[model samples]
Target: MSTELLAVRPDRSLTDGEAALLLELLPPERRERLLWQAEQREPLCAYGLLLLALRRRLGWRSLPPVARGPAGKPFFPDFPEVHWNLSHTAGAVLAGVSDRPLGVDIERFRPVTPRLLRRLGADSAEEALGRWVRLEALAKQSGTGVIAVLNRGLTAAEEASAHDLTVFPGCAAAVVLGEGEAPGQVRIWTLEALLEGLAENF
Candidate 1:
């Protein structure tokens, strides 16, 4: 299965004009959800922008309807064959798309407490964050969520399926793919490039 990762850093809050442009790409039902907290607007807008990019990359004339799985995982009901996951941190947002089931998670880096490090079973802050994201991605891929998976830990199968992703600096990220799916090159796009692609396609 072909898989791709996209990451964006929106350094500033989205302007009214830009928010309107991005909101046009979202389904009507999702519009109200975009009215998030002031701090969340940028990442939320970035997530919407990523969906637009994914739609164009998949050659879909229009964005597909999204549905949630039993575990609250969002997916395309019309495009069952397409698998995807999204994550957002303080200054960035990430999206992963594949032909098979996949999950991704990103977290902004912060100093890890000794207790937290031991809980996650890692030696350093980076290692701790990486391990945390891996577990979260694994849970997301299985549609079980991190709390469920963390309580039990990764099975041997899950251990082999997880892959670490190098996202923006000061952030930790990872992706988990279905068996037999390998990760492809990650494509990082600037906000201007994303806007340009959106303008050209939609």
Candidate 2:
């Protein structure tokens, strides 16, 4: 199964007007769900990144209808074979799609203090940050929220399935794919490029 990833820097996140245009492309239900967070830029920008990746990798002309899993994770019902997940942090936003199920997470790359390590229940600074993103990806892959996986350790199989990502300069990211599947490098897009994509005929 091929897995594709895309990441955007927070510096390049969309403006309200650009987000509104992407928002119009969503199905009514999804659009309604986002209206409440109209002031929140990350989700809108992250979702727009998802659509951009879908169009590029899957050759999708128009977005397929979206459905939510029990945990409120969105999926393409008509494209059940297609799996995807989105994530964002203070540093960057990411989108991933694959033929098999996948989950992704990105976190700002900041120094972790001993206190922070204690809070994360990890041994070292790097371990703390690494585990943080791992648990997030696993939770997302399982359709379980991040809270459910917080403080959780990776099993042997999980360790093998997860891959570290180096997309944005100030971010640490991770992605979980089908057990034993390899996650390749990401496709980085500038905000201007994504905006250009939005201007394309759908």
Candidate 3:
């Protein structure tokens, strides 16, 4: 399989193979849930399809039925060995998978209002905003969600210090578990390019 830096996009639709792979990973009940969501169209497509693509890409053997914790974090029963995290806002969703535990987040490149920034800010310093977001993303990936990080800010300082940060100037934002090494670089996949590649492959 070509591991040439997977760059899935917000607008690219899933191929039949991709969709089948997603269904294969989902448990029966979750399959129903995904099917129900798929019936709605548009936004769910970006979230669901990308999720399935990532799940397949990571070679998840099987997933437990969707189960939630008291804190409402989602979990899989069968594949606890694989760390998985999901985040989506406005136009896109991100799924990060890693062996060493990982978290990912994506945010559109828009101005963060000063007031909102102060309220969401993890620290008083401006430089810490990315750190805060990274921490939040990491927490989400860890199944603790932002509340855990927001509540206990100093914990997981080592993982939070993962400095492989990059900015994507497009319709969405994404963060994923890093291999402790910042990717030498990232490649962007436009919606058209992705569709063309799929077509050519077929």
Q: Give a tens-digit lDDT track for model 3, residues 97-165.
A: 444455566655456566656656534333345555566666665567576666675445445334444
* Candidate 2: tens digits of C-alpha lDDT, residues 1-202: 4888888775755676787787777777777888886355667667777788777777765577889999987898998998889998774789998888899988886789887798787887677888788888988898987776665656789778878988876677899989768878898877777767966845
TM-score of 3: 0.58
- Candidates ranked by TM-score, best first? 1, 2, 3
Top TM-score: which candidate number?
Answer: 1
Give all candidate RMSDs, comma-separated: 1.9, 2.5, 5.8
Note the clash tally of each candidate.
0, 0, 5
* Model 3 clashes, total count: 5
Which residue window of length 10 is worst by lDDT in model 1?
36-45
Q: Supply candidate 1's per-residue lDDT for 200.
A: 72
Give the least accurate 10-residue stretch of model 2, judged by summed lDDT.
37-46
Question: Candidate 1's residue-wise lDDT over 1-202, tens digit each?
Answer: 4677888887777677767777777765566666655565555545565576576676664556778889999888887888888888888888888788888989999999999898898999999999999998998888996988988988898888998888799999889998866677677877777766776776
Write down the TM-score for model 1.
0.90
- Looking at model 3, which ten-residue stretch has the lowest summed lDDT? 1-10
